[model samples]
Target: MRILGVDPGSRITGYGVIELADTKPRYVASGCIRTRNDALEQRLAQIYAGLSELIGQHRPEVVAVERVFMSKNADSALKLGQARGAAIVCVANHGLAMEEYAPRQIKQAVTGQGGADKIQVQHMVTAVLGLNATPQEDAADALAAALTYAYSRSGLVAAGSVSSKRKSSSWRHFTP
Candidate 1:
């Protein structure tokens, strides 16, 4: 199954795609969507359009996003929520399955600890996915989220299966 993990930010949203098969994860793609320092709504539109294009191109079986965590600045947190809201709208429009994982869950799944720092998480992500080099911080975080989802539900995803929307059925029934 191909899982698209999103790390939404107002200025730079990161996305990573990982295919899980035979209990292993292979990195498909990972990158950041950078938006100009324009108005908040404009930035949101950029995110929405970029994510929509990415979804169309990747056709992921599911999308997993990092749930919001509290920040020192309320305004920053609000902006993050708006950015995530845009991403969620795009995913829902595609009729794709969506899930959220807390930051600690993502870190623990990838690095075996909830309190692992960014560098540790980045190193573990590259090592686990066999990436050629450490991905950018945001991109690494995105990949970590993808790996977390994939590992947590390894039993449900099938390698070389076709992905389709059908009557609610076991994930094993869908070929992704």
Candidate 2:
């Protein structure tokens, strides 16, 4: 399974791709798309187009996006919402499964603590993924989002399989 993770921002939208096989996930690629602040519409268009291209290139099976958190600046939040909406629409239109995680959840998944700071998150991302350094901070966040999805789903699948095997074993014992 290939998961695409996005960290949406008006000025810089970060994205990462990870592929999972045999229950292990590995980072594939990651980067951020930047847009000029002078024109909102243009920036949105750039993000939309760039995202479309990326989708075509990577062909990710799922998309994981970071949910909006409480922001002090209303305008910033609104703009971010727009960018996020673009990503959501792109994923939905493509008939791809989308998952969203909160900032705290992503941080906790990456760092093992919900309140881990940016530096801590960045460091962990680099250390775990063997990323030479943190890819830009936002990019690091995006990678973490992708990894979080991979980790969560991997656990669920393993647990389900284990439960299924146990049920089958108990059923055989009772049948005899």
Candidate 3:
């Protein structure tokens, strides 16, 4: 299965593509869609159009988005929500399933700790995907989100685990 992970932001939305096969996840492509700060409408349009093109190019089975948390800036949070909504609409328009994962959940799923910092997440993402170098920070975060979704769906199976049943499946229901 091919999965697209999204980290939505008004000015810069990060995206990563990963292919899941035989209990392993591999990186395919990753990048960010950046928009100018001056034009809100144009920025939203750019995000939507860029995402649509990405979906067409990757043809992912599903899209996993990082859920929004309460931001200190209500304005920033609202803008992020708009960007996220646009991303979701693009996914639905492409007829793909959508899933939202909390930032903490994604961190824990990938790094085994909810409080993992961006650098820690990046290192783990690099190691997990066998990347020669760490991806761009935003792109790496998106990739982490994708891998997190794959592992979470597979019963929290850690990399290189040979067990039939992995960690407890309790987190499945908690996923949105």
Better of 1 and 2 by lDDT: 1
Q: What is the TM-score of each candidate against the true structure?
A: 0.87, 0.85, 0.87
> What is model 2's C-alpha RMSD?
10.1
* Candidate 2 Cα misplacement greater than 4 A, ranges: 156-176
Give the alpha carbon lDDT tens digit for every residue of 46-123 in model 2.
888878888999999888899888899999999999999888777766667777888888887778787898898789
The ten-residue window of minimal lDDT in model 2 covers 160-169
* Highest lDDT model number: 1
What are the lDDT scores of the predictions, listed in order?
Answer: 0.85, 0.80, 0.83
Instruction: Please provide, for model 1 over 1-176, each residue's C-alpha lDDT reduced to its tens digit, 9 standing for 90 to 100.
Output: 99999999999999999998888899999999999999999999999999999999998998889888999999999999999999988887777888787888788778878889999989999898888889998899999888877877874333322122222333324356
Alpha-carbon lDDT of model 3? 0.83
Q: Which window of 10 residues has the lowest lDDT sum in candidate 3? A: 160-169
Residue pairs whose backbone atoms clash in candidate 2: none
Root-mean-square deviation per candidate: 6.9, 10.1, 6.6
Q: What ranking emerges by TM-score with the best candidate at the front?
A: 1, 3, 2
